[model samples]
Target chain A: EPEVTQTPSHQVTQMGQEVILRCVPISNHLYFYWYRQILGQKVEFLVSFYNNEISEKSEIFDDQFSVERPDGSNFTLKIRSTKLEDSAMYFCASSSDSVTEAFFGQGTRLTVV
Target chain B: GIQVEQSPPDLILQEGANSTLRCNFSDSVNNLQWFHQNPWGQLINLFYIPSGTKQNGRLSATTVATERYSLLYISSSQTTDSGVYFCAVHTGGGNKLTFGTGTQLKVEL
Candidate 1:
């Protein structure tokens, strides 16, 4: 099965600095999502995007967070300013439909200092 | 939001042993997926069974949607099976996925 791919498997950034996590979703998927998992914690959904617009987002996905599909097949999550608490593994996922199976990427480990 | 609970928070088994893992959901979901997190922290999806049954090699899964539960069976597990098993559910109500705490399995060879 085809899988989603994420860049910069490991990222280390300074607090208050800006960063962008990129993903190339499955070639034929329709919906895109971003989820984060803090070490030893359950995964939490951040936002979902479809048709070039955000469909839903969790409270954790606030003004500081933004997602854009700058071009076909490429999705990105940008954090305006990083925080120490933001250190975690970020996963990207894609589904053929909103209510169906989703393929997840290996994840990008972001360490904010 | 849906509540997902996984039983047997941790397990230890000798290589070539059989084991069963369970997942219970609080509500109805359109889709459910099982994932294994390796020691390196990469999630490898094992199944995407919303209902009924599916098998792959020595692994099999069955979901009784009516009972709101799912079971994963690993026959003759090996040392490679040692990892954290997680179940995630997504209801049509929202795009967010509610995940269980996961079961940490250790297989001793």
Candidate 2:
């Protein structure tokens, strides 16, 4: 099975620093999504991208957050200024289409100090 | 906004027992998925049944789109099956998923 791959399984950064989470979605998949899970909380959707543009985003994806395909293979999420509340497990998921099963990566544990 | 609710927030069972997890949606949806979050926090896709029934080994799932609910059945549960089960739904007209808190299952030997 082709799985989504994430870089830096765990990330630790200063509170005011910037952090970029990288994901390489399944080669053939077209849609991409970013979700986050706070410890002991439900998974929350951050943003969804298709055709190189954001299809939708949650309130959590505010001015500080941005996502880009960058190229044909990489999907990246960057947080301009990190905060203590930003610490969470960020997950990357991809699907061939909306109706199909979305595959997820192991996740990047983002920790802000 | 669509609401996803999962029942029996926590459950404990013996290794050889059977368990059923339920998920209910507030409105009609176009996509539904079941996932297992292991101890290592790896999210594993278990099923994507928007409607009808499907089975894979000791696991089976059924979704009734019209009724807006889904069920995940784990038979002959094992210690390895202990994890958090999540149900997420994609409401019609939106690509984002709304997830329930999830059911935490513990299978003991």
Candidate 3:
């Protein structure tokens, strides 16, 4: 079965530095998303991307966050300046359509110090 | 925004036992899915039952769209079933999935 794949299973960055989390969703999927989970908290939606544009974003996806589909296969989330509170597990998911079963990647653990 | 609530925030079960986890949503949804987050923190898709019932091996799920609730049944659970189960829904008019609080299950031998 084809699955979503994320790069750099774990990352450590300075509090004021930038970080880019990359994901390659399933080959034929059309809709992509980014979600984060703070330790011991529920998974929260960040943003959804389709047709090279963001469809919807949550409050957590503020000015510091941006997503890009620079190529046909890569979806990335960039944080301009990381904060201690930004530490969490970031998951990338994709689906064939808005109403289809979305599959998730293993997740990238972002730790800011 | 929609509210997703899961029952029994935590559970402990012995190997070979059976259990049911429930999820309730505040509004109608276009899609409903069940996922298991293992110790490695990977969200594994278990089911995508927006309505009706579907079974996959030891796991089965049922969603009643009109009632706005979904149930996940685990039969003859094993130690490998220990993890956090999350129920997520795609509310009408939105493309993002809203995840529930999750139910943490620990199965011991």
Candidate 4:
């Protein structure tokens, strides 16, 4: 079965540095999303992208965060300056449409120090 | 926004036992899904039963949209089934899912 794929399974970055997490959603998927889970916490939604624009975003997705679909296949989340609290597992998911089952990638573990 | 609650926050079972997990939502939903987060922290898609019933091998799920709840049944549980099971729902016709507090299940030999 086709699955969502994320790059840089794990990343370590300085507190003031930038990081971009990349994902390649299923080829035919039309909606994409980004979610994060802090250690021992529930998964939290960050943002949703469709038609090269953001559909919705949470408070956690503030000024520092931005998502881009630079190409037809790549979806990326960039954080301008990492904070210690930013350490978490970031997941990328995609669905065929707005109301279908979304498939998740293995996730990229972001560690800020 | 919607609230999702999962029952029996934690469960322990011996191999070959049977178990059931339940999820309740506060409002009508457009999508309901069950996911398993393994020890390695990978979210595995188990079921996508927005309504009605779906069965895959020893696992089955039923969602009653009107009642606003869903149930997941695991028969002949194995050690491999040990993981945190989560129920998530999307309400008001959007793609963002609100996740319920998970039920952590541990199956021992």
Whole-model lDDT values for every prediction: 0.93, 0.94, 0.96, 0.95
Worst 10 residues of 1 chain B by lDDT: B90-99
Top candidate on TM-score is 3
lDDT of 1 by residue, A8-110 (tens): 8999999999999999999999999999999998888999999999999999999999999999979999997999999999999999998788888989999
Model 1: residues with Cα > 4 Å off, grouped in runs:
none
lDDT of 2 by residue, B26-59 (tens): 9998889999999988899999888999999999
For every candidate, what is the interface RMSD in angstroms?
1.0, 1.0, 0.5, 0.7
Docking class of 2: high
Off by over 4 Å in 4: none
Highest-DockQ candidate? 3
TM-score of chain B of each: 0.97, 0.97, 0.99, 0.97
- Tell me each candidate's TM-score: 0.98, 0.98, 0.99, 0.98
Q: Interface RMSD (Å) of model 3?
A: 0.5
| Colliding pairs, model 4 | none
| Better candidate by TM-score, 2 or 3 | 3
Q: What DockQ was computed for model 1? A: 0.79
List the lowest-lDDT window of 10 residues for candidate 2 chain A: A95-104
* C-alpha lDDT of residue B99 in model 1: 85
Checking candidate 1 for backbone clashes, the offending pairs are none
Give the clash total for candidate 2: 0
